[model samples]
Target: MPSSGETTTLASGHVAVPLEEEDEKRIFRNFPTFTDGASRLNPGRWLLLKGFKDVADRIYNFKLRESDVVIVTFPKSGTTWSQEVVWSMLHDPDLKGAPRSPLMDRPPYLEMEVDQWPTEVKFFVPPLFQAMCPGGDASRGTVVQMLEVEKEPRVIKTHLPLSLLPRDTLDKAKVVYVARNPKDLVTSFYEFSRTIKRLQFQGSLAEFADHFMRDELRYCPYWEHLREAWQKRNHPNLHFIFFEDLKKDSVREYRKLAGFLGSKLSEEQLARVMEHTSFSSMKGRDEALGKSDQMNSEGSFFRSGQTGSWKQKLSHDLESKIDAWTKENVADFGSDFKYFIS
Candidate 1:
C-alpha cells in the first residue's frame, strides 16, 4: 500500500496523492479485522475506502461553479432519493424528460475511483458503471475527471464530509445535505454493507453498530459529519434537509428543495416529481433497469424507506446503547438536534 502523501500518476494523467496520516494509531485502530480495505483521511479523520487516497487532493482542489448543485450526505442517507428529487427539480420539472439511465449515472459521485480496486474485486463493480468507466482506460477518465467535462449547472453527488470538499464549494455552489436519524441510517447501512462485496463486512448487526459508534465505518463519526453541516446550516447556499421530513411529507420537502434551487414548479410539475421519485416508484424503476442484478445484491437497492423502522430490527439492548451514544455525542448540539433521533 502507498504511504501517506505518496503521489502517483494515474492512467488519466492526473497526479494523485494519498491522504497524509496525521495519527496512524487512530486510523483503523479498532476493528482491524473488518476494516482491512478502508483508511482514514487526515484533518477530519473521516473514514473512506482506500481508493479515496488516490483522489483526495483532486476533490479538495476541485473547481466549483455558481450554478452547480451538490448533494452531500453520509452513505445510505437517502442520497439516491435526494439525487432523484434534485435532478428532477433542476433538469426535468415536468418529469417528462427524465432519462431511463440509473441515478448513479446522472449525478457523478465526486470521489469514486473503480480503477484502483484489485483485479479480483473489479468484477463486483456494476456493469453499467464498468461500461461508462472501464478500468485502466485513460480515455474514459476518473469520476472527478468526468465531472470536469460535464455540462454546466451540473448536479453532483458526494458522501464526503464538508471538510474534504473544495474550500470554495459553498461560495461557488448550492449544497443540499440530507440527514437521516442514526437509527434508520445505521440499519440501512448495515444491510447495505452486507450487500456490497467490497466492504467485506461479515459481522452481526450488533458488531456493526459498535463499529459505527466507534466511527470505524466509511464516512463515519456520524455525529461529527452532521455537526459540520449543522454549523453551516445558516449559510445561504447550504440547504439542510432531514430524511424523516421527506418521508413524512415529500411534497413539502420537494417544494422547499425546488425553491432552494430557485426553480418554480407548477403544482402539476411538483406532483409529477413527487410521484416519479417516490420510494415505490424508484424501487420499481430500479427493478425495471435490473439494478439489483447489476449490484449483485440479494435484494433490491431501494429497501424499505420507512422512518423509525429501526424499532423493528434493533434489540432492546442495542437500541439503548445507541441512544446513550447519541445522547453523549449530541449533548452540545441543542434540542433541535433531537429531531434527528426522535
Candidate 2:
C-alpha cells in the first residue's frame, strides 16, 4: 500500500505508487537485501520493478493496432534473440534493409526507462547510440514516447506480463512469448544482474537463486508468469517459443516463427535470417554496436547461448533445489510442459 505523498501522477493522469516495504516483505517473505536501484510495485498481480509504476497505466491504456507485433518474455529468456528474429522477418525479410542501428532502437523496448534515471546514476549511453534513437537525443524522449510516435505495424518488445499490458493487447496485436527453463533463466539473470550497474548486485549465484525462488526479483513469481501464458497457449494471436527449442534447432524454430508471424520467406531468405540471428553473429553485432561495453560489463551481452549451460554454473545442491521447484510449480501445466524443462 502507498501512503500519502508516496505516489506520483504521471502525465497520462495515472497515479503511480511503489509498494510499501512492509507489503513487499509480507508478500515476498524471503526478500533479500540486494538492492537493484529500484523498488517493487504490484500494479496488478505481477510484480514489476519501480520505474514501470510510472508508465504502467499508460501502457495498459495505449492503443494497439492489428499490425503491431510484441515480443514478450521474462528477462534473460532469449528476448533479444526473439526480437531479432521477429524484427528481421517483419522488416527485413530480404535482409538488405536491416539498419546498422542497435536492435534496441529497431524493435524498441517498450518499458525501457533508462533515459529517466537521475543524471548522476544513469548508465552511459554513447553519443552514437543516443543519436540513433527515434529522436536524436535519447534523454529527450522515453521509449514509450517513441513507441507512441512509431509508424504502424510496429515491432515492440517488453518484459511485462500479458496482464500488465493494454487491455486489448491480445485482441489487437500478435504476441510472441519466449520462455526458457528456470534453471538457465535464473543463471543468466544472475550473471546479468552482476553486469548491469543499475542492479549493483554483489551477491553470489546461490544468493541470487534464493531471491529467485522466493519471488523477490523483478517480474518474479516466475512460474505464475509462465503459467498465465501457458494457459493461453492456444490463443489465436499469441505464439509460444522456447529458448531450448531455439537452441536445439534454430532454423526449424525460426521457420515456425516466420509462419506464425505470417511472413513467407523463401528458403534463401530464411537462411539469411538464420545466419544473421545466430548467437555468434548477434554477439559480433552487439560488440560492434558497443552494447557489451556499456554498464561496465565484464561479459558480453551474448554469453554461451547454449542449452544445458546451467549444468556448468549451478552447484549440485542448487540444481536439486531448482529441479524440485520446477517440479512443484509446473505440475499443473500437465506432462507436456516437461519438454521445456527436459
Candidate 3:
C-alpha cells in the first residue's frame, strides 16, 4: 500500500490513496460530527458529506490559479443551474456544439465524493484520468485527482463557506457566490434530503424545517454561510448573486456573469444562452446538467423554480419561524439583501 500523502501513478495519471486508518482518525478527530437517525455527519462545518472531510481538506489546499473561476453556494441554491450557465458562458458561447460531456465531467465538483454519492448518479468519467488511487474502482474517481487533471481557466464548484476555502486562493480566483431565500432554500433542501443516501433524513417536512432553523442540516447555519460571503461581497474578485434575482431577470444576471468573466456576448448570443440555461430546458433534458446525486434518485430536480414556492409548502407557523430566525441571525445585514428583507 502507498504511504499517506503519497501519489501513485496510474495508467491514466496520478491519484492519491486514502490515508492510513490511524492517520485519518487523528486528522478527523479535530473536527466535530453530528448525527440524526442513521446519518453520521462527518466533520466539515458546511456541506457535510458522510466521509468526505479528508476530501474537503484536499479541496481547501487545492492549488488555484488566478484564472480559475469558482462557483460557491449552499447546496440546492441553484448550484447546478448556475454551473450550467457559467459552463456554457465560458465553454460554449453559441450553444451550437454538442455538450463536450456532462457538466460534472467538464467543470467537476471540487469536493464531490464520487464513492459516497448515490449509485444512480452516473457520469462519463473517461479513462484519460484516474480519478482516485488504487483502492477506488476505475469508474469512480476521486474529486481531487479529477480536478488535478483539468486544464487552466477551470470552473470549479464548492459548497464550503468562505472561511473554509483556501485562504491564498480566495483573493486570487474569481468567486461567484449564489444564495436563495431561506424559505425556498429550506423547502428545496428538505425535498433534496429525501433523495440523498447520506442525509438519512427520515422525518416530516416540519421536522426537517426545524432541523433547518436549528442549523442541523448539511452545509448549514445558512445565515453564517451568507454572512461570511456577504462580508466579502466587495472583494474585487468575488461576485454575489441571488436566486430570486436570477429568476426575476436571468438575462441581466447572465449578462452580469458574462461581464464578471470578462466575456462579451451579443444580444443573439445572450438570448441563446438564456434559452439553453432556462430551468425548463435544463430540467427537460440532460437531467439538470447531470451534476447532482439527488436528481439522479429523484428523477426530476426542476420542481417549480419560482421565486417564492415556499408560500405553498411551508406552514404559517413554520414560515414565522423562518422569518424570525432570518432576522435574528442576519440582523446586521440590514435590508440590502433581498432574501432577509423580502
The local distance difference test score of each candidate is 0.73, 0.72, 0.67
User: For residues 211-270, what per-residue lDDT tens digits would candidate 3 score against the true structure?
Assistant: 677565556668888988898888989999999999998778989989998768888888
Tell me the TM-score of model 3. 0.77
TM-scores of the models, in the given order?
0.83, 0.83, 0.77
lDDT by residue for model 2 over 219-307, one digit each (tens)? Answer: 77788888878888899999988888888888889888888899999999999989988988888877744354445647456778878
Model 1 stretches astray by more than 4 angstroms: 1-37, 98-100, 114-141, 288-291, 294-297, 339-342
Q: Which candidate is the best by lDDT?
A: 1
Error of 1 at 340 (Å): 6.7
Q: Candidate 3 at residue 290, lDDT?
A: 40
How big is the positional error of residue 77 in model 2, measured in Å on the Cα after superposition? 0.4
Clash count of each predicted structure: 0, 0, 3
In model 3, where do residues sit more than 4 Å from their true spots?
1-50, 114-141, 197-200, 287-299
* Candidate 1 clashes between residue pairs 3 or more apart in a chain or in different chains: none
lDDT measured at residue 211 in model 3 versus the true structure, 0 to 100: 67
